[model samples]
Every structure is written in C-alpha cells, then in structure tokens.
Target: MATDSPHPTRKALRRNVLALLAVLAALLATLVSVSSASAAPTPTIVLVHGAFADSTGWDGVATRLSSKGYPVQRFDNPLRGPAHDSALLEKKLAAIDGPIVLVGHSYGGMVITNVDDPDVVANVYIAAFAPAQGEFVQGLLNPIVYPGSRLLPPALQVKVVDDPTGVAGRNLDGYIARPYFREVFAQDVSVATAADMFAHQKSAALVANLEPSGPASWTRVPSWYLVSGQDRVIPPALQRFMASRVAPGHTSEVGASHVSMVSHPAAVTAVIEKAATA
Candidate 1:
C-alpha cells in the first residue's frame, strides 16, 4: 500500500539521474582539458631549397624539424628564375593556415625574401643568400676576386632544349670541381651521400627575371641567419654581409659547408626552433 505513493521516490530518482549526468559532464570536460593539454602544438615549416637541388635536399632538415614536433613541407622550387620561384613559394605560403617559419637555403633565400606573406613569422637563412634592396644573386658572388674563389666551381649555364614549349634543358657540368662539390655540397655529408647528391644535381637556370628587390622582407619579419664558416659557394663573407644587412640579432655560425643543413642538422634545427619560438 505504501509503494502506491511513488511521486516523491520518482522525483528523487530523477534528481539522482540528473546528478549522475552532471558528474558525467564534469568528467567529460576534465577529459577534454587533459586531451587539449596533451595535444602537440601545430608547427608549420616551409623549406625552400637552393640552386642545383630539389626538394629532397631538405630531407635531413625536415626530419630534424619533424622530430621536434613540427609539420614540415619542402617546396620543390622550379629553380627556373627568381620571379617564377617567388610566385610559386608565395602560393604555397598562402595555403598554410597558421603562422609559418620560412626557411630558405642558398638561392631559396631570395624566394622567401620576396614572398609577401603576413603569416610568415620568421625567415631563417641557412648558409643561404639573403639579398637586400637592389641586389641580384649574381652580385652576391665575387668576381673571381680570390684564389679560393677560383678553386670553387664555376657557375652552371642552363639553357632550354629545342622544344616547342621551350622547356627542359641539357645539364652540362659547368667546370665545377669534384673537390669543390665535396667541400660545398657535401662537407658534412658522408662520401656516399655526397656522391649521390652530385649524381642527382640539376641544372638551375639563371634567374633572368630577377630584379633589384625594392623592399626587403627581413625588415618586416624577424630573421635568423646561419652562417656556414666554410661555405665556398656563396662565400662566408657574403653570408655575413647579408646577415648584417638584415640586422638579425639571432645570428649564428656553424663550422660546416654551404650544405650544412644536411651535414650539421642539429645546429640548423636549433636555429629553426629558435625562429619558430621567436
């Protein structure tokens, strides 16, 4: 007979169910907070390789950056000309949603320098050319000014093959010495890696579309420059001059060759990490 009056008990049961759901909601919110805390930060790095090289040249650097929890993409630059490459790089930079660290190697430096992307938080030049206003890549090279320069390889002259589309070319070795290649391209690389690089070397077309850069990107964006002490290609002095032009406070020197990113990845990665955080 007493069980017939179930209103109070049923109300209590509804309260219990509501309390249980409230507890579950709190637990779910806590779980979400924990998941958010444990989730890795999204880091985007765009690597632009230099002359006579493809996107694969950044394989070593990409691995190091990825190991540090960065999402990295290496742009396979046409190596055609500065204007064309810069346009391509700008398009790539536009596609990235978050802030990005633009790392340029050798001539790729010029490409990053010209890309006018606001999302680009930092520009990292790894033993690469950092051109300033009214400068061309050709101007960066000394005019056979030093004996050491003479020892380095001569610049390759790229010409398009006879095709209706006027694309493709024959890559003739441009008087580059094996020792010079070994020193500049494979200084930190193993003998085998160096050999492989040489075998895969592509002919980079002279940037005929290159014009005097009007305004410098380093001026607006923070920059980090990695100087290769033994860089025979651009000359260490040139790197210093370029770094100074930007007035980058975060300047570093590694006792490696022009391709130090491949040889001394740890050092290069340190600079990139710094740039990303900065």
Candidate 2:
C-alpha cells in the first residue's frame, strides 16, 4: 500500500476541499429558500370610518399597525349611498399590489358589504352593520332588526342638514348632536377626548343610511367580528347578530363603545391582525 502512496497528502487535501464545497452548496440552498419565504409580502389593512365619524377615529389602530410594519390605510368613507361608496372603494383597491384586510365600523360596514373584492382576504366588522342584500341600514336600525335595542334614536341624536344644492335626497347630511355624542358614540373615551372628537364630527347623508345595500361580500370572503359590549351607536345585540352571521368562531367582544377603535384599540387591532395573518 505504501508503494502506491504517491501524493497522498494532496489527494487527502482534495477530498477535504470537495467535502467543504458540498457543505457550502447545501447551506446556500437553505439560505435561498428562507429568503424566498421571507420576501413574500404581507397584506395591507384598510379601515373605513362610519357616519358621524371620520378616518381620524382610527388613529390608534393605524399607529399600531404602522409600528408593526403593516401598511395601514384609514379610509374616509364618503358617507354617501352604498353603491357609490363601494364603487369608490373598489377603484381604490385596484391600485393596491397585495392582499387586504378590510375593516368597517358602524355604517361603513354596509359600504364594505356592497363591494365584491377578490383581493379582500377577510372583512372585520367592528360594532358595525352587516345588512343582507336589499336590506337598508335605516331599516336595520329600526325595531325590525333588534327590537329591544336601546341605542339613541337617530332622529333625536342627529341634526338634519338640508342639501344646499337643492337636490332633494342627495346631500341631506346628519351630524351627531354634540350634547349626546358622549353617550351615543364615545362613552368609553375620556371626557376631554370625546369633546374634541365631537367638535370635529363629520356628517353623513341621511339618505345614504336609507338606501338599500347590494349582495354582501361576506358571502365569499372569510370574516372576523368585534362586538363592543356597551356600544350605543350600534346596539350590542345588533352587533352580536351580525358577528355570528359573518364569523361565528372568529367573533370577540370588549366592554367598549361603538368607537372601540379609540376606546379599546388593542382589541380592535388584534382582531384585524388575526384576519391579515390568516
């Protein structure tokens, strides 16, 4: 054997070099796989504000999402009729590159229900309406939806503003009366903050709530719902019914108001994130 041992050290060195090269190749492949998985984009979360509220109500939720590296959109729902609002949302959605988790509060829920968006992974309702096809929000708020509901009557809590343009049903806006704003919408929020929010209230068209909604997006998309146990704008009973209808197992509740995003943003944000990751 020793007689055949020419350049044995060199042969041994070559073998070791080949083994090291194979190890590097395997490590490189593993790195590439992990890189691909990590590169996949996460979804965007869009929050649609309801009537008597604006996109600013979602400030806390938006900040939380942004800090966690999620792309957040606080949409200003026009408070127009369902079809018109849905059309605008659909067009805006066309520009987004990734998936979306659409969240709606109060009347905004009706708006989201009207849109047919394939990109929406899930619809998250936050003490919001979930009207079926041909069901108007105004009708749902009446005794027919949740008969024993004690939410403030719209006629008393809202100030009716006539359309200055003389359009009969177009711009008849309704603003939440400042005096009842605390009890009706933001009871859970601090008095100072509630007052500030009331000062900047945005009016919604009275006709918009009266208009009928189209087919519900929940018919196709998966959904998560958060019921504010003490919600005054949208009754707790109505919220529970909607939640059960949309997503039975995915529903949660907090002892908050209709503006839960402000009073209990953590709970609202958690539900939204659950949908996004799902």
Candidate 3:
C-alpha cells in the first residue's frame, strides 16, 4: 500500500497457493475414503443357536470368523415359537449397518427360516431345520418319516410350565434328558464338554416345534446347508431333504452330531464364510 510493493503481492500469491493445496488435499482424502469403504466392507455374521443350547455354543465358530475380520454375533434365540422368535430376530436384523451372513443351528434354523430381512444376504444351516411354509419342526421329527432321529421318548423330557407371557397359555418346555444329552445332541464333542452343555442347556417351548412355520425366507434368499451325517436330533436324512430344497450345489456334509458348531467349529465356520463371500 505504501508504494505497491511486489513483496506484498508475492505473499498474497503464496497464501492463495496454500489454500488451494488444502482444498485439493481434502477432496483427495474423501475420494480415498470412499474407495476404501466400497472396496472391502466385510459383512456381519449372525450365529443363531438352536434349542437345548445357548449362544455360547457358537463361541468357537464365532472366534474363528472374528479372527478372519468378520464381525460375529451369537443371537440369543428366545426358544419361543417360531412366529414370536422370528419377529424378535427380524427387529434385531434391522438395526445392523451392513449385509449379514445368518447361520442357524438345529431349531435355530427354523427361526431363521421365518426371517424375511433383506439385510440377510445368505442363510447357512448347520444340521438345522429348514422348514417350508405351513410345515412345523415337529413334522421333521417323525421317526417314520425321517428315521434315525433319537430325540424322543426316553431321550427327551417335557415339563409343563406356567407361561408368563401367555403366548402358549401353558408352555410345554422340551429338554434333552441329561443322560441322553451327549448321545442325542453332541456326541462328537468331549464328554465333559457335553456335560457342560447339558448343564447350561435352555429348553425350547414345545409349541416352538409344533407351531407351523409362516413365510419361509429360504424360498427367496440364497442358502447353504451343512448336513450333519451323524446328527441324532434332526437326523441326516431329514437334513438332506431340506438341503435338496435349497438352490442346488450349496450343500455340504459333515460327520458331526447335531451340535456341529461346537465339535466341528472349523467346518461349520467354513460354510458360513463361503456364504459370506458368495
């Protein structure tokens, strides 16, 4: 201003260059962030436990999946009837931020079969039920129809309990008799571990097995099945029948008991990861 100094003009040019550089840096950062986010966003894995078991049964599988960078959640299945249990699961699925790889074990399969969430990218059944609309889990337990099932009579126990929710009026809870727990549920696992599982077992409402399934998501969603060759609770033959209904070429067999996730966690985890990547 005193005499139109070139030095002042030079200082103004430097400031403009610095500001422009800052703007470009910000844009570059945003683009890189977007690209990185789109390139490798891992899907969340939700593991649902079946009757006579709780979420802890998924500990081994969940840990393996988590180590591979997939987020894992072991859903605490209500053990209530399918309609009520599915409603609760659907609500939880809605809150998740990204795609989900849903894995179900035993009766947990029936629960996932009823969920219609769009976020559920794939369904992986681990020696689990995959019922059709109007079909009930109890139907699959028929020894005449799906022979080799050992979850009946002397191997099982049913207790009449007062329903607090009044959904079942008088709830009938089904449990795998203590002595038969290992044989009927998890023969592949260690005897001590099976005993531990028996101690923490959660009974499923009898209505859960008898109640007819509503809309089945397996009809629409992509599915993968792991047939437990030695499964006593659901029977291998029944597993094959259900797996056949799924889109062909997505089924695998494991020589495991009904609690495959506990005894063969790696094999079960592999199926889940396959579904996730697909």
| Top TM-score model | 3
Kindly list the per-residue Cα lDDT of model 2 for residues 4-32, writing each as its tens digit. Answer: 66699899999999999999999999999
Model 3 residue 183 distance off true place after TM-score fit, in angstroms: 1.5
Q: Rank the candidates by TM-score, best first.
A: 3, 2, 1
Candidate 2: minimum summed lDDT over ten consecutive residues — where? 149-158
The CA lDDT at 123 in model 2 is 95
Write candidate 1's Cα lDDT for 224-266 as tens digits. 9999988767778778888987645889999987788878888
lDDT of 1: 0.76
Q: CA shift at 130, candidate 1, in angstroms?
A: 0.8
Cα deviation of 194 in candidate 1 (Å)? 0.7
Candidate 3 lDDT over 1-278, as tens digits, reads 36666998899999999999999999999999999977966899999999999988998998999899999877889898889888999899988988988899989989999998888889999988898899998887777887888788888899887777445567779898988899788888998999889888998888787889998899989999999998888879889999999646999999988888999999998999899998
What is the lDDT ranking, best to worst? 3, 2, 1
By lDDT, the best candidate is 3
Each model's lDDT:
0.76, 0.84, 0.88
On a 0 to 1 TM-score scale, where does candidate 1 land against the true structure?
A: 0.76
Q: What is the model-wide C-alpha lDDT for candidate 3?
A: 0.88
User: Model 3, 260: alpha-carbon shift in Å?
Assistant: 0.7
Name the lDDT value of residue 79 in candidate 2: 81
Model 3, residue 162: displacement in angstroms? 4.6
Kindly report which residue pairs in candidate 3 clash with one another. none
